[model samples]
Target: MEVDVKLFGDLREGRFEQEKTQLEENSRVIDVIKKCNLPLEHVAVCFVNNCQAEFGQVLEDGDRIAFSPPVGGM
Candidate 1:
């Protein structure tokens, strides 16, 4: 299956802003993070097709996955 991935904050520092990636059927949110070479600890949140998602959330073809890294601000 193919999915769209979006990286935010530090997550995008050395990665593309967005990408179209391929994964096996039933791939999960954490699988995408691993494929992107991002540390699991760096992700603060994840959204699938605009809805908040958990690491184990199974991904579907054409699903849009967005990841946000930990942010610090006043």
Candidate 2:
């Protein structure tokens, strides 16, 4: 499966702000985070298809996810 990922704040450092990423079947939101090598502690807000989502939320193919940090931090 594949999903679109958008990273905000320092989460983009050493990474990309947006990209289409490949994933295994039944992957959750947190799986995408780990695949991006992101720091979970830095994620202040997360949305899936524009709705607030949790780390354990299951992702569907072609889902769009945006992750943001707290204002100035990541």
In TM-score terms, which candidate is top?
A: 1
Write model 1 residue lDDT over 12-71, tens digit each, in one string: 987899999999999999999999999988899899999999999999999999999877
Q: Candidate 1 — what's its lDDT?
A: 0.94
Q: Using Cα atoms with residue i matched to residue i, what is each candidate's TM-score against the true structure?
A: 0.94, 0.92
lDDT of 1 at 42: 89
Clash count per candidate: 0, 0
Pull out the clashing pairs in model 2: none
lDDT of each: 0.94, 0.92
lDDT per residue as tens, model 2, 1-74: 99999998788999998999999999999999899888888888999999999999999999999999889542
